[model samples]
Target: MNVDGALAPAVESILRTARERTPGEDAERISVDARSFSDALADAEENGRVPLIAEVKPTSPTTNGERTDDPVELAETMVENGATALSVLTEPEHFGGSTENLRRIREAVDVPVLRKDFIVREEQLDAVAADLVLLIVRFVDDLEGLLSAAEERGFQVLVEVHDEEELREALDAGATIIGVNNRDLARLEVDLGTFESVAPVVPEDTTLVAESGITTTADVERMCDAGADALLVGSAIMDGDVGENTRRLVNA
Candidate 1:
């Protein structure tokens, strides 16, 4: 596969990280007890409320360092404040995240943890024991194969997309859970309309997650109104009181 699609610099950095890992280390095996991430998300809403999958990214290419000094503490606070699941950034370089963060956060919370990283190889999948994993459609050459591999590794897939074509591609690749990233990979620009525009085309059976640019209660409501089952928020929640910000979104 040519993998000729134009990748954003942040994603390119992730691919570089994957390529740099030692051979067997990339494929190093792990055995974790099965936790149904699909069900965890599906059951998150018990009283007609949208679930909030709060994130623990230390930083991003756009945002250099994290506000939270203790990621595990922040993760615990989120769950205690009604977070349905957790999204932990495991990308070390640009994001300032590490597998150590995911491991600690996962142990602190019973809710499913999403291993959010630029996953390009099967070995990357084996490195984390999180219950869920992210798979960006534009970032990989074989979407179906990676989705299947994640499932085989006992993790639910959060297949991300930015447009109609990518949505269709994800569906065709058997993506049961789809997240519409508001930020365009090419320009690294955000517009929540990305979710509104592509949502109607999504099947009712597939779980829909809204990622990025969701900062306020209104933002949460907007995403819910646009048919999102959940929201994957990081920066906004991490910027202030984790509990308060999380509860605000949860109440939204």
Candidate 2:
């Protein structure tokens, strides 16, 4: 339930902007039509490899020193390097990203795009305008309601968890796609062992995604061996040669 104090102010700004932009009529209008998460997984499986959800992150609260000013070029580079899906960080201030970046990236890429942010409320969902939505278990107080709202909006949800209890909560909320984040959000530390520790608890039917601290073929191989169906990589890809890194990680 704990989150970075800095993120609170950033989330407030995002919510305020979203409220100002959304009209009363549009706010009430519900669009239940969208692309399926199953389709994205199927495409990844058909390719005979785990789906790579490459991220276009400008900055991170944990890694405040590192930042990328250009999201459009980052998104284009990720797509060109054979990324099955694009994950764009839309939480500005803390992560230095915006929905504008996601919208722009979605417009530029043919692949499905995921809005990677700390999803707190239903109103925040409307602002993303992405095919997929990421909901962190630690941050969400109403897991079921968020999942239901995401489903109603026609956006696939990637329920993120760092521990057994959170993982169970995600499943109980009917999350078909689950991401085991290796990074400890509270302490801002990375532990590769988190995946191994939580692998046994993942249900057989759910598509598992390994998030954070993945940098090499060995890391991908390790996660794949532990039953990860896909990998959501960000800093590693963003900071290095994306094309070569993509070929190495995906082909590995």
Candidate 3:
């Protein structure tokens, strides 16, 4: 499967899987009340630290294997330890995630949940019951239309962008929450500086989130210093003691 220069083979493969995948019966309904990811972040910021959106990623193309912790239990621990929200990977084959994981985690925790997937169509939104949904700029054909579709589904869109052009597209699409992804999907390489470079160009009113390659307290502080309202972390939390790691990053 070929893709644009900005998309890596791994990401391209995930999109292919997403295209072929269909929503289950449960996806046809919305089961829970949607929490406000924006409100959660705003409330956390008042506490004097950058808010954390810890991820419930069982596995990834870059990781060795799936997490041993139960998804719901891990999500509860994250919320208990101070995660402002949770990001759940729902792409099954490469990421080892499922909508069931999102549903269970959403039911178990009070914080807003983010359905992180390679969303390329509106049908994907039907399967998501999260408060927030990730829309990577490079994956979707019409960013504005998709954003509207997501809004119609009662979700706050977290538009993920890898570069300045994508960032402009997101802003033009009227995205209120934007995530600066440091990992270049084309090569699957992470560089924390990506956020630092893009942060200056984002509007002050936009709720900015820094994603990927963040692993330490220093990294968290670096992003906060660069004007990130929230930080989305996965491998750092899942690879260590979930509670301790969540506390450590949340406190940072």
Highest TM-score against the true fold, candidate: 3
* Window of ten residues with lowest summed lDDT in model 3: 24-33
User: How does candidate 1 score on lDDT?
Assistant: 0.84
* Residue-level error in angstroms, candidate 2, position 213: 0.6
Q: Give the higher-lDDT candidate: 2 or 3.
A: 3
The model with the greater lDDT, 1 or 2, is 1
- 16-122 in candidate 1: lDDT tens per residue? 78667532444566556756666666677755545989998777876655664798998999998888899998877778788889999988889889988888777
Residues 119-160 of candidate 2: C-alpha lDDT, one tens digit per residue:
777776877578888988767778899899988888888999
Q: Going through the candidates in order, what is the number of backbone clashes in each? A: 0, 0, 1
lDDT, model 3, position 9: 72
On residues 4-48, what C-alpha lDDT tens digit does candidate 3 reach at each position?
Answer: 576677777888788888786566744435788778987887876
Q: What is the C-alpha lDDT of each candidate?
A: 0.84, 0.78, 0.88
Output the better candidate (1/3) by TM-score: 3
Give the number of the best model, judged by lDDT: 3
